[model samples]
Target: MTSRSSWNTRNSDVAWAKFDPIAYVDHNYRCIQEDDAEILRIVRDHFADHFRTTDTTGPVSGIDVGSGPNLYPALAMLPWCEEITLLEYSPANVRYLEGQVMSYDANWDQFWDVLREHEAYRSLGMGPRDRFCRAVEVKEGDLFDLARHEGR
Candidate 1:
């Protein structure tokens, strides 16, 4: 089993320690530009209810467990949750996610466009990338250490 501190140290043994953020985006996120209609449909269906109401009863907070350098999955949760806690095991990935939030990257445009293509999201007429950066909060934590990460 992976120890709690194993990823904390970012040991070379950890496969994710060598993760490449730009390459990851190029490989995964750019697919949205290719064809995101189906993706938008699925995610929109999952999160459509969250946008129907403007009250506090809706999902107020959500967590991205083991979030790597990927941002699309978090984008999928954007409409449903007000605050998204990005829990990452690798320090490298944590820093990467934090950097993206601190400064929105232009490369993510395709991903945002894909999300915005949905009628529900398109109606917002707002910048999805900017909104995503604002809503996300990065936290470094262990995925296996149930005691510490359970209620976070």
Candidate 2:
């Protein structure tokens, strides 16, 4: 029988890890869903509006904590960031993200389709693999273990 952590998972992140990153990515992201497309648009638009007037004299760093097998979040920050971090807890997920970042899976192209609809995203004017591989960094880490950062 498979064991599960019994600790109160409601208010905390304490738990045992279990998931198949390959299966998860294939099932959820391999085929672009309506929900995922909507989310990509929402994130893209939100970021577009948020940074519209801000004077970002330099490229900023971005991080997605407990990012799992998802790459859309990191994609949303692609234009504005010089470097991005995908911090995941699962070992399998870390490996998956590493490969995906280095040699970005083609499945994510649909997600980029939505992102490119935005002015900032399209303004990038470069291929996704070149831009993404240049900017993304994958690290194995849990959410609760993070140290305080200056940003919100």
TM-score on alpha carbons, each prediction? 0.70, 0.85
Off-target runs (Cα >4 Å) in candidate 1 are 1-14, 31-37, 49-59, 123-126, 146-152
Highest lDDT, which number? Answer: 2
For candidate 1, the per-residue lDDT at 95 reads 84
Give me the runs in candidate 2 sitting further than 4 Å from their true place.
1-16, 148-152
- Candidate 2 lDDT over residue span 84-104, tens digit each: 989888888888888887678
Q: List the residue pairs that clash in candidate 2.
A: none
- The TM-score of candidate 1 is 0.70
Model 2's alpha-carbon lDDT is 0.83
